[model samples]
Target: MKKIIKTVICIAALISAVSCMNNTKTLLPNVSGKAGEVIIVVGKDNWEGNLGNEIGGLLARDCEYLPQREPLYSLVNLSPGAFSDMFKLHRNIVIFNIDSTVVKQGVVYRTDVWAHPQCVIQVNASCADSAIVVLEKNGENITGAIEQAERNRVIANTLLYEESKLGDVVAKMIGGRVHFPVGYNLKKVTDDFIWIADEKQYSTQGVFIYKYPATDEDPFSEENIIARRNVFLKEYVPATAENSYMTTSVFVKPGIKFLKYHNLDFVETRGLWEVYNDYMGGPFVSHSFYSKDGKDIIVLEAWVYAPKYDKRQYLRQTESLLYSFEWDEDGNDGK
Candidate 1:
């Protein structure tokens, strides 16, 4: 009888031990959450949309990023050891904060951010600039997830004003001559970049090519540049009248030629407009002008309708974007 009792006790103890080990809670990253609150497991903005409130809900779930440009200070936010580990999981989302202050000699430099997997190749600063990342986990991750109720929130409010400013300006200029954005919004905006584009139509062709991963398309292939061709527009833009007819004209500040620009033909025309292999499509915007002859430094944008689009439906799915134009040189639009 004593031996049987002792055997029962040992079996019970073994069972309890096994249960505790099984319920110890696993340590792994998860992608789910409520609005506004960020999930720190990953150091990037994983929000679904580029702008607005619904973005808040998605933001809590993962780190989303403005992939159009290289991350500088944000990459440094995470500790080197932590960042290296996160990168192993193939994290694509990113969060970038473009904070700027005026320094001597009239220069604006962006000085900070909060993110993972970052770099600063384009900024006019050092790669060794210091940065930090903050992590917060409230409740059981998805405890208080709220839908995007605050439409007038910071992200939504800012995007509305600026997007309207750019969209309205372009819409007014084009008016009826060409099809402006049927729907538009700022998918991404920062000190260095701004993206104000929506899902709209151009010619009666199928889907526009800007709808693909721009980083992997052949700009020279007819399968691609045809969108720019299908919407054959003939207009006279009163440019600086100098490099106005060059085949490779890059008119933004500092100038990024053979990259982003339209071939408008009003008074003058130039350049073999080719979408670079790395240029991603969707949520489009017209390029910026270096200087201007009044306000009509007119740039005509061309778009076409895809076969099965739901009429301005894709207005909400832009990936990574920003707005700003700094490609001009000496106000000469260095071609």
Candidate 2:
């Protein structure tokens, strides 16, 4: 009797382990389509009706910072029955359940339903009209979640990349560390500033780090930050033409806001940048915050110049580098 009881307990434990494994498998990192691609799983009949148009208008909106027109996310529609195992692994997805029995129109947000690091939103309604209303009501939340997931992925991939020596180099010079990608290098360095850029054939992206003496505890004002940025860019970042340098465009007023990232308070600035004497410009973003020692203020700026392609993805990839900033404890090597 004792042996039989022990055998039963062992079998029960084995089943429990298997159940846990099954539950955790979907939480594994999702392997799916490229960023900005969302799979829409709905019936074919609804996909061609007014409901489809509403869904498209919500999810396929135009992205900002692009030269031409490009959807924020490309939607690939597939019938519910056809949403096979292959489609289940997508990073972002939406499903519509339009049935009379659903009673009320509603939207649901899910995570890791089929794959790890995945977002799945389901809209259920009694009819096509109700479904459209549901989508219209929750469109912003749906798109915002997708964008946040993409940003998180970018940060994750950058942190997982091999630690470049640039982090340590910057730490030694400026007392701050950033995870610069493998291709970036020190384009220009000065006593109080450093410029790092990744120049491609038709796209050029750069990040500049600098520090200056802080007078008091007053918050950085928009006018003061812009003036300082103009001075620094004029001295360090130059265009291909003679006597031309990068500066914030006066046409579009720069925007400033206070935000906290990675537990550090920073004054965020965003605006269009233009070459003073040249026909070249793009979008730029900066984060200004006080240093740990309270003696200096550090500014980290990221800018892009992609005239031929969509600047949104390029700018996002470059801007994420700023959030990777971390202060080196020992102040020796930024390892």
Candidate 3:
């Protein structure tokens, strides 16, 4: 009788475990919308009023370092009534709920609400003015959330179709690993510098990885970073014309900002690059950070050259790869 009881208890536990797994499993559909697109849901009055203008200006502002004016995100505004099932599947969504009965008066961020890999930001306020205040207070957070969502999507796709060989090559060069999607090839590999690119007929997306000994001086300074970049480009990257090489453009000054991602602190620089003796130029961004041992400053830079098409998407795609970088000891080297 005791043996029979033990078997029954074991069966019951297995059944309970299966039940819990079923309860926790969620089968969400894939997200909709193209890369760099956002869906904004608001009332008609709010959409036409100052609150809408504020949201639009904040989210659709010009992307930095682009040669031509391009909004950071392509926004699509729809009224609350018009926000149907189809629109709920969008990758990025912001819903503004401003009514007298609203009990909550802040921003609430959610993910994978209606679709997989989606970002849904809901703002609840008592009135339009209050909504504007909330937005103003959390504007940077809002923008960052959506930007991260977009980047995560890119990183996901990259991992799905990753170029495993490139990770090995990068690991050997920099003592770290970076996930490179298919279509990219090793353009050049040297002792201290590595170049990987996806060259097409009309466009070129590339990444450069190099390291230098860290000094007591501010190695992450803009002047030093740019000087190092110019040196590397002049030596390794060349243009079609004789004596032409790539370098940072002096027409527009580069901007630098300190950012922390996944506990790694780095200085990000954004600017344009031009061929020294040629007319070709485009946008470029780089992240400079200390190596694992803090003895060297490693730089990962991404640049886009798409003279015939808009560069915002191209630049974002290439730039996303830089964020996928991981040190070998971090245990993501397989990625």
Candidate 4:
């Protein structure tokens, strides 16, 4: 069997890693052309063969471009402002997703200075490109794909404290589809989380995983725990039992430190999925860390059916909140 390597990272780590080089900033890169005059056409289909070529030709009929061979985009003569404005105007027109195939919303070229900003980009030999571009890929689930893509773009668009550092982080994701949710008010999230009163010490973040079968198997039951633990330690993998019941994990950012759950039973949500024939419960083993500036705490969590193993992928697939914790500020007030 192929090895399945799983890893988890919070928003803090993401930002910190991306901005690993302290020289980058939130302002858009310098551009050499006009942004408003450009229009970036994302592929509505798997534009691998002649399809992409045809679309490029059709768009070129109206727009002009510099003489170049093997263009990465269908159009590129306009400046950053023009490119971003055009996307905002007709982004909904070409939103498409073909089954098993890939449809891409070409990245956006955006900058703060909208009026006739000089443009500079990758092709420039010695000038800095003052623009930010991001891609939107429509998956098999088109609506969900777009929604997620929008969220990704929104997050990629946000330039917070040391805000300019985000560009470097995204540049690394040049050919990948790692998506993130966006637009929620990111002010100290304080719901379900009662309080964080400690200003002197770092708070804790954690996750807990429990096994629940799709069939009628009580996950919290003692018999189920013993059976699953044996299967995991002896077999090195989770064996599927009847009814399809499986495991899940919950992530949280706490104001105070949390103790390990050697043996604890948690109440299930009042949802249709919770009412099953068999259910088993378990405790939590959390991984804790501090924020970049050390003002906030971050938790690294996963479920261990056996020592040194976690069911993080399962929770991310089923519940969106499974891997989510708090995203705190660096407490850095830029001077």
Q: What's the lDDT for candidate 1?
A: 0.27
Please provide, for model 4 over 1-335, each residue's C-alpha lDDT reduced to its tens digit, 9 standing for 90 to 100.
Answer: 12322223455677788787565654543323321223333333323334344434443332111111223222433323334543434322222122223233232223233222222111111111111111112112322332233333333333231223222222122111112232211112221111111111221111222122323245433333434433322322222554434232212211223222223212222111110124432233333333343332222322222112222222222223222222322222311
For candidate 4, give the lDDT: 0.27
| Alpha-carbon lDDT, every model | 0.27, 0.83, 0.93, 0.27
Total clashing pairs for each candidate: 39, 0, 0, 45
Deviation of model 1 at 272, angstroms: 26
Please estimate how well model 2 matches the true structure, expressed as its whole-model Cα lDDT: 0.83
How many angstroms is residue 39 displaced in model 3 relative to the true structure, after the best TM-score fit? 0.6
Task: Point out the higher-scoring one by TM-score: 1 or 4.
Answer: 1
Error of 3 at 87 (Å): 0.7
Question: Each model's TM-score?
Answer: 0.21, 0.79, 0.95, 0.19
Which pairs, if any, clash in model 2?
none
Which stretches in model 2 have alpha-carbon errors above 4 Å? 1-30, 43-58, 65-69, 103-107, 124-138, 173-175, 214-220, 293-295, 331-335
Candidate 3, TM-score vs. the true structure? 0.95
Candidate topping lDDT = 3
Model 1 alpha-carbon drift over 4 Å, by segment: 1-284, 287-290, 293-295, 300-324, 331-333
Single out the weakest 10-residue window by summed lDDT for candidate 3.
Answer: 326-335
